[model samples]
Target: MSIPYQLILTFISGGIICVIAQLLIDLTRLTPARILVLYVSVGVLIYAVGAFDPMKDIFGAGVTVPLIGFGANIAKGVREAVEKEGLLGALTGGLTASSAGITAALLCGLFASVLFKTKSKRM
Candidate 1:
């Protein structure tokens, strides 16, 4: 398709995920942490089943920037690790694969915290 169509698809795909997350937050008792875990778990499942590959081709970062994408990375890491390192790979692969991302996130958070002050929420 064209660039415009791809952009539309990407926006819609990401928007749909956001909408679902918001609805769950508004209409259910589940906490944000649980919802995030659900998204990541679903991502891993979809990745494991090979469903996310085609979607990634179409949605690009729209599909890959979310927690689900993180989960897919974890699954991919474990798979490759298992193939190369035997059973121990199952235990260490996810952490090793995601370590950079986790470190980046921590560094970013630290930088932001240093650059800004937290304000108390006023009810």
Candidate 2:
């Protein structure tokens, strides 16, 4: 059986994103937190320039599942909110657009904490 072309593109795109992150970890002094911020910022910039939709169309979930996607989602939310709610949207839009994701993350963390013992890091 032949592999689907979309699947191949998805794998390759996602892999490239992962590889870039790994390289940053291996070769740079930047902390993981900084790298994450950098990625999200890049995503926001891409969305600002109106490149995100095309990239998402090509990369599918490969683009949408990453931190960059999260940033784009926030930007989208803010834009829509600003259009609908005036200046107040800027303050609430990101959280509103990302609420489901934020809720899931929190619930997952709660479950994990309840289910397993976390080890404290020693400084």
Candidate 3:
């Protein structure tokens, strides 16, 4: 199937994010996981405030294509649930919506452990 523009944009944006984060990691002492968490948290907070919607509208899946896209997805899902279920949505919507990201991360980690030996360095 042909890739849609939205997805293309998402991939590009996501790559840029990763690249920037990688650069930050290389230049500073922060770890990759920390940067990833920071990016996701910022995305979530921005999304919760309703600012991320316009970016998504303009860029389509482009904005949602990256790791932080999960955060946007969570915000979007929560907003929709809140619209339909009110306070109850607040209880489960975000987790339910953002499950894909979490699952992906977990699966990847499991795969890495099975495939590679990660020994901590003892100096």
Candidate 4:
């Protein structure tokens, strides 16, 4: 596909996914964290069923920039590990695939905590 069309698709798809998440937030009691986990699980299921490739192809970054993409990445890593390391890969593949993103988040949070003053929310 051409770059312009891909960009357009990405914008629309990303916005749609966000809209669905927002609606879930508004309509359901589920926390945002749970919703995010759900998205990742869904992504993993889709990837396992061989459905996520077309999504990645069409939605590109729209599908990939979110937690669902992270799940797909985990699933992919697990598949590779399963090929190379058998059951051990099933245990460690997701963590191995996701460590960079996890570490980046941790480091960023650590930096922010050190640099900024903490304020307790008044509820």
Model with the higher lDDT, candidate 1 or 4: 4
Better of 1 and 3 by TM-score: 1
> lDDT per model, in order?
0.90, 0.90, 0.80, 0.92
Report the error of model 4 at residue 15, Å: 1.0
Work out candidate 2's RMSD over C-alphas: 3.2
Give all TM-scores, in the order shown: 0.87, 0.88, 0.66, 0.91
Q: Candidate 4 overall Cα lDDT vs. reference?
A: 0.92
lDDT by residue for model 3 (1-123), tens:
245766776677667777888888999978978987888787888798888888777666666766567777777788889999998998888899988778999999999999999799999
Residue 90, candidate 1: C-alpha displacement in angstroms:
1.0
Q: Over the stretch 1-123, how does candidate 2's per-residue lDDT look in tens digits?
A: 134887788889989998899899889877899989999888888898999999898888888898999999999999999999999999999999889998999999999999999789999
TM-score of 4: 0.91
Q: How accurate is candidate 1 locally (lDDT)?
A: 0.90
RMSD of each predicted structure: 1.8, 3.2, 4.4, 2.1
TM-score of 3: 0.66
At residue 41, what lDDT does model 2 achieve?
86
Task: List the lowest-lDDT window of 10 residues for candidate 2.
Answer: 1-10
